[model samples]
Target: MPVDKTSYLLVDGENIDATLGNSILGRRPHPDERPRWDRLLAFTQERWAQPAKGLFFLNASTGLPMAFVQALRALGYVPVPLSGSAEDKVVDIAIQRTLEALGERDDDVMLVSHDGDFLEAITPLMDGQRRVGLIAFEEFRNSGFHDLVRQGMEFFDLEHDTRVFNAPLPRLRIIPIEEFDPQQFL
Candidate 1:
């Protein structure tokens, strides 16, 4: 079926990164050598049949590399940096709040994360007024959230098309801190 509504793509950056690293790369590479943001965004836009407003959630205390942040911006994704407080569940809470706020809108919502913590926030939005879906790694197919599928949420498996989402392993670059040059890295 053709998707006719605008999609708000909320990406759980850390969660997706870990999944892709383990499933595709076999090991997590440095953030600098990770997924090609531009390609991923294009793929999502095509899947939804509309230009999605991408919101990538990142933990503030983890400290994202400046280059990675710039690349995300260049690819048109808004980075929502939140505090990393285990006691508060900062990232998840921020995402839930955004989902709640967007629930009143007419557009569809697509969450890119396998963490089932979102179920609580997503359940209420499944009301028939707007479409809600998930973009998750197939490796997590058995994740306790399968109930979401039965609830009418569409699931897009990233593993089915690894070429688009899996970035090629980056060449090893070993250099001294004094010799490190950010320009040459990109």
Candidate 2:
């Protein structure tokens, strides 16, 4: 029997947290500054016009953060806790393998990350067939991904496009003329 084709929403939790803390916020984010995972799922479903299966990948080598994992589960995310030696990039490896496996399925994929490590994994997936999207703050995204836009890869701003966070993010991105509002400066 054929199963339903659901959009796969893959999240790189570590990359996002690191980028937010080190680059965007200049420190660890408060609870309110975190993206609302529910909104991301909703955006994926609506954008692709299909049910989205949200998978959040995290490094669990140091032990699982049960509270965060439980919260993710409550918000409809499947927490993929991966463990490995101190030198291993466990989460990235797991996500890459998952992406490779997805090649056999007809499901659309939306990857939430700014890391360039997945470039090789996602490059072949955009063979002018299955829909693939990247969710990240534009200014922080890898320049390699910016090239993918020409190859029909859909790029979205996590904060502006998805409106996933309760609090505004400090992103220095060029706004499209249509979205420019001068009143904020006054």
Candidate 3:
């Protein structure tokens, strides 16, 4: 099946960074994160028949900072802030909640994260006649998620995805800082 133009791409902010730059050594490095975003947009351009809306789910309690979220908003992504004891858990719930929102309208949902916990929440959407995809890295890829990936759920690896291109960053911008301006700092 071709990519749905009306599909919504819901991103797990932390999951995306982790899967994109994560390593066995923990918090390794990926250099540049822009290429990842570029590739993601390019993929959507080629795959979707219409412009898709990007929703980034972030954890507020994790101290993600407002400036970064504003930057993401500036980049044209809708920021859905989550607050709770655990940011990750909250993000998971937020994803499900957003999924439910889409469910009400029978709209397709695409998740760009390697979190396996979403498999259960997304299955219901799929079973209910909705579409979803997972854009993630190979290292964190779980077999359980493969079924979802195979069932019209698109999965793109940064290493293999042509949209990500060959551009690598001088450093990873995973950490949040006050008034982050890449041009001024980097």
Q: What TM-score does each of the candidates earn?
A: 0.75, 0.96, 0.73
The predicted structure with the larger lDDT, 1 or 3, is: 1
Q: Candidate 3 lDDT (Cα, whole model)?
A: 0.67
Task: Sort the predicted structures by lDDT, highest score first.
Answer: 2, 1, 3
Model 2 / residue 144 / CA error / Å: 0.5
How many residue pairs clash in model 3? 1
TM-score sort, best first = 2, 1, 3
RMSD value for candidate 2: 1.6
Report the lDDT of model 1 for residue 34: 56
Which sections of candidate 3 miss by over 4 Å?
1-5, 24-35, 62-64, 127-130, 165-186
Candidate 3 residue 104 Cα shift, in angstroms, is: 1.8
**Alpha-carbon lDDT, every model:** 0.74, 0.91, 0.67
Note each model's CA RMSD in angstroms: 10.9, 1.6, 9.8
The digit string of per-residue lDDT tens for model 1 on 1-186 reads: 854667788888778787657755678766555556666677667776787888988888767667767878988999887776668777888999998898777788888788888888888888988778887765564465588788788887654442443544432434569978899759
lDDT of 3 by residue, 70-147 (tens): 877777678888788842488888887787777666566667777777777777777646556667665566677878
- Which candidate leads the pack in TM-score? 2
In candidate 2, where is summed lDDT lowest over 10 consecutive residues?
167-176
Using lDDT, give the best candidate's number: 2
Which of 1 and 2 is ahead in lDDT? 2
lDDT of residue 44 for candidate 3: 63
lDDT of 2 by residue, 103-133 (tens): 9888889999999999999988998768999
